[model samples]
Target: MQFKILQLVFLFAICSAANAATLNKQVRSLDWWQHASFYQIYPRSFKDSNNDGIGDLQGIIEKLDHFTDAVVDAVWLSPIFKSPQVDQGYDISDYRDVDPDYGTMDDLKELIQKAHAKKIKVILDFVPNHTSDKHQWFIDSVNGVEEYRDYYVWANAKVDDDGNRVPPNNWISNFKNSAWTWSEERQQYYLHQFAPAQPDLNYRNPKVVQAMKDVLTFWLDQGVDGFRVDAIPHLVENEELLDEPKSNIPGYNDTDYEYLDHIYTKDLPETFDMVYQWRQLLDDYTNKNGGDSRIFMTEAYSDINHTMLYYGSADGSQLGAHFTFNFYLITDININSTAQDIANTVNKWLDAIPEIYTSNWVLGNHDKHRVATRFGVANADGFNMLKSLLPGVAVTYNGEEIGQENGEVSYEEGQDPSARDPAIFDKVSRDFERTPYQWDDSTNAGFNTGAKPWLPVSEKYVETNLKKEKADPVSHFKVYKALAQLRANPTLISGDVTVKAVDEYTVLIKRSLNGSSLALVFNVGNDTATVDIAEDVSKSNKIVLTNVDSSRDTGSTVDPSNLKLEAHEALILSF
Candidate 1:
C-alpha cells in the first residue's frame, strides 16, 4: 500500500510542473506587440499618386502591397495634420484635419479601412507640444481673444536699467535663437522651443488639456489603432521662466541651444504626470471599445532611469507609455563597439524596464542618419539580426531593408528650416536621410513620374533598389524578410533573452521558452572568427538561417564543436 501511495504522489507532482509551464506560456502570448513588427512611413516621401511631386494618402494606398509583402504588422506615419510646411509636417496648423498637401479627410479614412482589411494597423503621429502660429487658437491668443487669451505661453518683456527691453528669460530655441519671440501685436513675448512659427501650448490651463484630449478622441473615433506621441519630454516646462545653466559638455554643433544644460526648459516632472493622464484616457477608450488595447508610445530620449519612468511604476498599476523609444542602441552602439560592450548596453536597457511593460528597439528614423550609412553595408545584416532577435518590438524605417544610404542635398536644395540657417547649414541638415524611397532603377527611381521629387533620389538607386534586390536571392532585403518572418514563432517573440560575449568580435544571443530554444551568433567585425559551441549546441541543432554564403550548406548537420563565422556574418540555430 505504501509503494502505491508514493507512486501516485510522484505522478501528481509531475503533472503540476507541466501545467505551470503551460500557464506561463499562455500569459506571454497575450501581448499583442510581442508578435508584431512596425514599419515607419514618411508619407511625403513614400509615393506621389496625384502627380503633384509630393506623396499623399492616395500614394500610400497604391503601395499597400509593399507592406503586405514584407509582412509588417503595422504602419506608423509621420504627422499628416494640416500644416504650413514650416518644419515639414511637425508644425501643425489644424489638429483635426488632414493636410491638403497630403490629402483630404476622406482619403485618410479610406486608407485606414483598406489597411484594416489587410490586417494591418495604422498609427498616427500626435504632436501635443506646440502648434503653428497660423492655428486659430494661437491667432486668437495673440489677438487677445477673451476665451483663448491664455491658450499659449505669453509673458511681458523685461526692461533693464539701460532702458532696453529684452525677452522674458534667457531661454534659447532648439533651432538656435531666443525661445521667447517678441509679439508686436500683444506687446508681450511668446515661447517657442522650435521655430517661431510653432508656438508652445500652455498645459497649465485645464481648458488646453481638455482640448487636446478631444483631438485624440476625434481620431480615435476614426479608428486609428494608436499614436506615437512626438517630443513627449517637451510637453511641459517649468512654470517660472528661468535662465538655463551653461553645460560643461561641449555643444554637438555650432547651435547655441546645445551650449546650455536645458535644465529649466525640458524634461520636467510635470511631463510624466501629463503622460499618466494620457494613458488613462487611452485605457478608458480601449475598455469601452472592446478590442485589442490601444498602444501609446512616447519619444522620450533621456537617460535610462527617466525613460523607464515613462512606463509608470514598477508594480504596473499606474502605466503611462506602452513603450519609450530606446535611443541608446543607436547612440551607444557603433562599429568599434565590442561584443561585451553591446551585451552590457542591451542588458542594461532590458533590466531597467519592468516585466509588465514591453520594450522597443529603433535602428533608424526620419530624424537621424540611416543605419546603413552609419554602419557599413557589410555590417547591415548583422545589425538587422541583432534588432529583430531582441526580445521586443523592432521599428524599421522605410527603405532600410534594402540598405539605402543617405542622399546628398546641397544647401540650396535643403528644406529643413534649421538646416537652412547660415550658421548651421551643413551641420544640421536632415534632408539627406529623408529622401524619397527607391522602388526601381528607372527615371525618378520610380517614386513619381511627374515634376521632380520633393527631394532628390539617391544616386545609387540604379544598383540598389527593390527590383534589383528582389531579383537577387542573397540580398539584404531577403535577409530582412526572413528575420521578420521569424517573429511568428512564439519562442522568438516571448522568450527570455540572454546575451553571451564569445569574444571581442563575436556575440551570442540565446532565447528560450518552455523547452524549446534558439541561438543567434553575430560577427560584428571586419575579420573572420570561430567560436566553439560544443556545450551550447549539439548535433540535434540545425542552422535555420545564415547570412554567410559558405554556411548556407543545406541538408548538412552543423558541427557543434567548431562553429565558423565570416566577417559581418550572422547565423540562427534552433535546438
Candidate 2:
C-alpha cells in the first residue's frame, strides 16, 4: 500500500525531528531565568484521574512521570481557564479555552506534549489581572454592549452632582469593597478589582488590547511555553487624580488589613505598558513559532526594588521577569537568617533592574503556608523551602519535596472559596495551603482511591511519599535533588558572587564561572564553629555537598589554620 504509506511518512518525519532536537536543546540549554527549577501545579488540588474530586488535564497527563525524577525543570500550571471557579482559575472565562473542569483543549495539548516529552516546560497561569463575571467580554460589556462596552473599568457619575450613582473614585478592592461594581446592566459603574465576581479588565481598551492579543495567540498557537502572570502589577489603574497615603494607624481598628496600600492602584506606570505589551506579544509568537521557548512571569505584590522596576518598563522595553512573592512573606530557617535573607533579596534585585533583568523565587505558592507550615515536622531543613534564593527562578510547591505540612480543614472541610471570604465570609478556613498531592502512601494519599479528597492529605504527608522518598537517604527528596544538582552547577548558573567570612560562625560563598572556582561553606551555629578559610581552604577539603551524610564529619575538621562548622552544615568546594 505504497510501502505502507511510505512507512507512515517516515515515522512522521522521525517524530518531527525528535521534537526539533528537543526544543533546540531547550534553547541552547536553559538559563533564561537562571537555571530554572520551577514546579508549581495547583490545578484544583492536583490529581484526580477520574475519581472525580477534580484535578484534571488528565491528571496532569498522568503525572508526567512524577516530574521525571524531580527537582524538576519547569511546569507552573494553575488556572486551567474557562472559570466560574470564581477566583480559582483566577476567574478567566476563557483565555483561549481549556476548563471542561480541567481537560480538553486537546487535554491541554496532551499536557503540553507530555511536558515537552519530559525535558519539561509548560508554564500557563495567566489571569491578566481579571475577568469572569462569567466573562463573555464581561457579559458583553455589562449589556450596554457598545462593541463589548469598552472592555471594563467603567464609571459614569464621577460624583453625579444630581443624577446620583457615585463610584469613580475612592478605589480600594484588594478584596474588601468599592472598586466599583454597581453594574445594573449598563447603569454605569463597573470595575471589580476582585470579588465582584472578578471584573476589572480595561487596560483603558484598544479593543481590550486586541482582545488580549487574541487570547495570547491561542496559547502560542497551542504550544504554551510561558506565562505565570495573575495580578501582574494590577493591570494599570491610577492614571493620576491622586489622594492616598494617610494612616500610620498604630492605634484603634488597625486591621482593615492596615488600610491597604496597593500604591495608588498597584505599581502603575501603565503597569509597565501592560507588561511591555505582553512582551511584544510573546515576542511575536515565538518568532513565528518553530521550536517554542517563552516565559513572561509576574505576580508582583511588590518589593525588591519595586520588583526590579517591572523589568524594562514600557519601551525601554520591560515586562516579563517577575518571580516575586518572596516565600509568601517569609518562612525562615536561619542559615545566618538564610544568608541575610537572600542578601537583602539580592540587593533589591540588583539595584532596581537593567542587567538584562529577570528574577523569580516563588517558594511555596498556592497562596502560602506549606513548607511544613512552620515546622510542624517534615524534612525539617528545606534548603529555604526548596528554593535556596540568590537571584531569581525557583518555584517548588507540590508537596514541597516530601515535607508537606498544613492540612486539617474544617468549615465543613472547605475547598477554597478563597478560604471563604465573600464579604467577610467568616465561615473560617484559611491556611492549609490548598492540599492534596501525596503521590502514594495509599488510601486517599495516593490522591484518590476515593473516600473523599478535594483537599486533605498532609498527614505530615504520610511518611513523605514519592515512594517513601525514593527510599530515603536523609531525604527531603534527596535534598531537593542535591539542591537542584548544585543549583544547576556549571559554576552554579552564571556565577559571580563573593560573600566571605571566616568568622562569626563561618560563611564563605565564592562562585566564579568560565574561569571555574566554587565555595559554599555555611554552618551558621549550634555547637561547633571555628573560622579562617581562604588560604585556598585546604586539608584536602573536597566534601562537595552535605546536608546530612556523605561522611567526613566536617572535612576532618577542615583547616586553613582552623576551620570548622557542624550544625546545619554545608560546604560545596570545587576549584
Candidate 3:
C-alpha cells in the first residue's frame, strides 16, 4: 500500500509539470479568438441612451465595463449601419455610415477605440447579401441607371396564357411572400430572398462585388476588428430562374415560407465562393496592415456539411472563415433532449469539421428564443457549461449569462417583421427574445430611463435581472464568469475534447492536455443521475465549477467512481 501511494504521488507530480509546459507552449501559438468568449449584443435591446426608447451605440459604449467585468474577450453588435428599420438593422441602406437611430460615425470610431482599450475586439454585422430598397444603389437600379441597372437581380416578368404578368420564378421570400417584386420604374421583377424591401445584391456583377469589398475596407479603415457576415448563404443564388420543389411538410401550405425546399434559393455553390472572396479580402487587409487577425464569423444556417465549408476548402488549403456560427446546440437540444441526443448533435459537428479549422458552439442568438425558455430554465446553465467547456469558441447572446427567459409579447405589441401577420404571431414572433435587457429591478429593467422601452421588458426582470443574480452566491451569471475565466486556462484552450453519453440522463465531456484532465458532467434529465466516469478522469476529483441549480459546491471532493448529479445539473471537475 505504501509503494502504491508513492507511485500515484510521483505520477501526479509528473502530470502537473507536463501540464505547465504544454500550457506555456500552446498559449503562445493560439490566435486571439481561438479560445475567446464572444458575446453578441443586439443594439436595439441592449440599452437605451438619450432616452429615445431605442438602444444606441452610446449605450453599448456605456456598458463596455459590463463586458470587461464578465471577462468577454470580444463582442459582435448586430447591424449598426444606416437603415430604414424595415428588418431592424439587417436592411442596410448605407454600409459606411452609422444609422442616426444608433449614433454618428464618430460614435462608432469612438466605440472601436474604447473597446480596444479594454482588450475587447469589436465585430460589426456585415450585411452583404442585400441592401434596403431605399438605398441609393437600389433606387438607381429601379430608375434604370446604366451602371446600377444590374446591381440587383432583375428579370423580366413571365407572361401567362391569360396575359397576366407573373413573377419570374416560384421562389419564395423568407418573409412568406413571392421572392420577386415588380419594379414600376424599370418594369422588371427584382429578387428579394428576404423581405421585398430588402433586395438581394447581384454578386455576379463584378462591380457590386468590388463595391461590397470597398465597404469592408471602409470599416477596416475605421479600426473595426472584424465582421459577422449576416445571411451569408443568401449572398448568391441559382441564376437560372428555376422553381423550387415543394417541402411537403405536414401542417404547412404554399403561403408558408417552409412550404418550399429552398434548394435553388439557399446554399448554392456560388455562395461558398462569395464567402471565400470576402475571406480573401479580410486576410489581404490583415496582411497589408499590421494588426491582430481580422476574422469573419459567417452566419450560414445550413446543414453541417455546407456549414463546415465556410471554414474553408475540405483539403484545408484555402482559408474561408475563422469560424462559422454553429447552431446545432441551439436548434437541436431542447426540453426533451437526452444526453445521447446532445452527444450526437455535438459529435456531428466535431466529426465533420476539418482537422485544421477550429470549432464553435452557439446556444442562442437574437433571432432564436432564449436558452432558458427553449431548453427549460432548469437546463440553461447545464447547456451553457457544455458550450463553454467544448474545445473551441463559445458565443453568448446578451442576458443568457443570467438565464433570462423570453418575455411575453402580444401580437399587437410585436415589432418583428416575421411576426407581423397576427394569425401566426405567436408561432413566429421573435419579439419575445428581443425584449429589453433586464439590468436591474428598476423601471424598464434599467435598460432605459425613457417613458417606455422600444420593446416590453420581461416582467420577471425584478427577480431575474442581473443585479439580483450578481448578489447571489450561486447564480447562472457566476457560473458563466467562472467558465469565461476557465477559457483562458491552457488545458481548456489547447486540450483535446472527448465527449460521451454516460447514460440517457448524463453526458460526460473530458478535456485533456498533456497529462492534466478536466471533466464536465451534465445531468440533463429530470432525476438524480449517478454516474461513474472513473475511466474518463482519474487524475483529480475536485469539483471546480457547478451549475447554478446544482446542489454540489465548488472545491468539494468527489469520487469519480460514483458521482451524483441533480436533475439539470452540470459540474466541472478538475483531475
Candidate 4:
C-alpha cells in the first residue's frame, strides 16, 4: 500500500509538469498582439543622427537593438509625416512622405525593413481628422477650385443682431478658441477642431473617405503593420451645426474650452461608421496579403461603455477598432487609490469589453504625465507589474521603463501651442511630458551632438538612464524587461483575471488558464501589509517573481500562509 501511494504521487507530479509545459507553449502560440508588448516612440524626442538636435528615422534605426533587448514586439511611432510643425507633426502637410526634419521616405522604408528583420512590427500614427492648411487639397479648396471645394468643412459666416460677423456655431476648439476660422480668400469660415492650421476634413464627402483609404493602402503596401488612429471621437461632428450646451460645472483647470459641454462637436455617431469602413479596408488588405489581420487601435478617451462602442456592436457584425486604449488605469489609479478602487476599475473595463475582443492598457504617453511622477517611484513598480500581468496588450511609453520623471519646461522653453497660448498655458501644457529621452549620463543625455535638444532632458539622467539601469540587477528597467518576457506565458496572456481586495491597501489577482494558476499580490499603499494564502498555494512552494528584491525564484518553495509585503511591493506566485 505504501509503495502504491508513492507511485501515484510521483505520477501526479509528472502530470503537473507536463501540463505546465503545455500551457506555456500554448501562450507562445497566441496571436502577435495578444501576448505582444508595445513600446511607443515619440520620434522627435527619441534619437538624433543628423546633429540637428532633432531625432530622425536613422536615429530610430540605430536603436532597433534596444527594442529587441527589451523584448518589445512592436514600436508605435508618433506622426513623422511631412508637416509645417505648427502643431508639431499633428498638422500634416502630406501623409505619404516623411517630415524633412525627421528624414526621407527611403529612411522610413529602411526602418520598417530593419524592424521586421528583428521580429518587431511597426505602427505609425494616422491623423485622419485634419490636415495642414498648406496641404495641396486645402490650398486648392481655398483657391476656389471646384474639385477640392468640399474637401474641408467650409461654412458661410452669419451677421449677428449687432451687425458683427460671427461663427456658424458656438463650438469651441480644443485649443480654446472658436472652431471656425475665417478665411478671407474663400469668403467663408472653415472648421478647425485643433489649431487653425489643422483644417478638419469633411467626412461627408465620399471622395474624402476614398482619399484617406488610399493613404492607408499606401502605408500598408510599405509593410507597415498597423496604425494608431488619432482622436477617433472627433472624426465627425453633428451635421445640424448646433451650439454646444453650456456646462454648469467649472472648466478643467480653468481652461475656457471646458466651459461648455462638447455634445455637438465630438463623439458623434457618424464616427463609428467611419471607423467601420476603415476596419473593413484593413481586413481586405489582410486578405489580399495573406498576412495577419492589420491592427486598428483608436484614441477614444471616454467612459467604459462609450469607449467599448469602438470595438463593435453586440453581435460583432460591424467591427471597428481592434483595441480602444484603456486609460482608466492611468487617469484613475494613483498612489492614494485603494486596492479595491484599482480592482473595481480594472474589472469594470474587463466586463465592458466583449469576450471576443482583446483588452489594452496604457500607463503613460506623450500626452499625459509620466507614470513615475504621477504614481511615485515605489508605487510605479507595483502598477507596472499589474499592467504587464493583465490580460491583453500593454503599451509602455519611451523612457518609462527606467522610471523617467516628467521634465521641467519654463514658459520660455515651452514648444506646444497650448503652452504658448496665454488663455490655456497655465491649465494645459504637455511640454513637460514630451521631453527628450535620456539615453546615458553624458552631456545632453547623449541624445544629440549638435545644439541643445528641442526639449530639455530629464534632470535625473545621471542615475535614471538605460545604461545605469541595464547594469543594476534590481532596477525598474530590468523589472519591466522581465515582466515583458514573462507575458509570453499563456496563463497571463489568455487567462481570465479574478480580483479580490485583501485590504484597502493590498489587492490579490489570480490568473488561471487550463488548470494552471498564478497569483499576483500588490501592496499599493505606503505601509506594509499582510494577507492569508490558500493551503494549496502555501504548500505549492511557488514564488515566481517579487518586486521587493527583484528576484525570479523558480526552484525555491515557501510557506505563504502569512504572506507579508512591504509598501509598494508585488509578488507573483504560481500554484
lDDT of 1 by residue, 447-559 (tens): 88857888888898998898888777567787788778766665666678888788788888887777666678888888998888767666677556666243453223567
In candidate 2, which residue pairs clash? Answer: 311-318, 312-317, 312-318, 360-392, 360-393
- Output the TM-score of candidate 4: 0.93
Model 4 lDDT tens row, 1-575: 11222232343354357577666556534567876788899999999988788888999999999999989999999999999998879999999999999999999999999999999999999999999998999999999899899999999898999999999988888887788999999999999988889999999999999999999999999999999999888888888788888876753433357777888877788898899899999999998898876887999877777698898885798898888899998877776889899999889888888887888889999888899888887766777888888888999999888888888887778889766765555457888888888888887787887578888887888878888877664677776876776676667866767876788888888887787777778888888787776633546655555663433343345556677677787777666
RMSD of each: 7.5, 23.3, 4.4, 5.2
Error of 1 at 18 (Å): 17
Clashing pairs in 4: none
TM-score of each: 0.92, 0.34, 0.95, 0.93
Each candidate's clash count: 0, 5, 1, 0
lDDT of 1 at 566: 87
Q: Candidate 2 — worst ten consecutive residues by lDDT sum?
A: 1-10
- What tens digits encode model 3's per-residue C-alpha lDDT throughout 327-385? 98888777888889999999999899988899999999988999999988888888888
lDDT of 2 by residue, 440-519 (tens): 78777777667566666667656767778767545556656656655644444555656544555455666654445456
Q: Pick the candidate with the highest TM-score.
A: 3
Residue 500 local lDDT, model 4:
68
Model 1, position 263, has a per-residue lDDT of: 82
Error of 1 at 169 (Å): 2.0
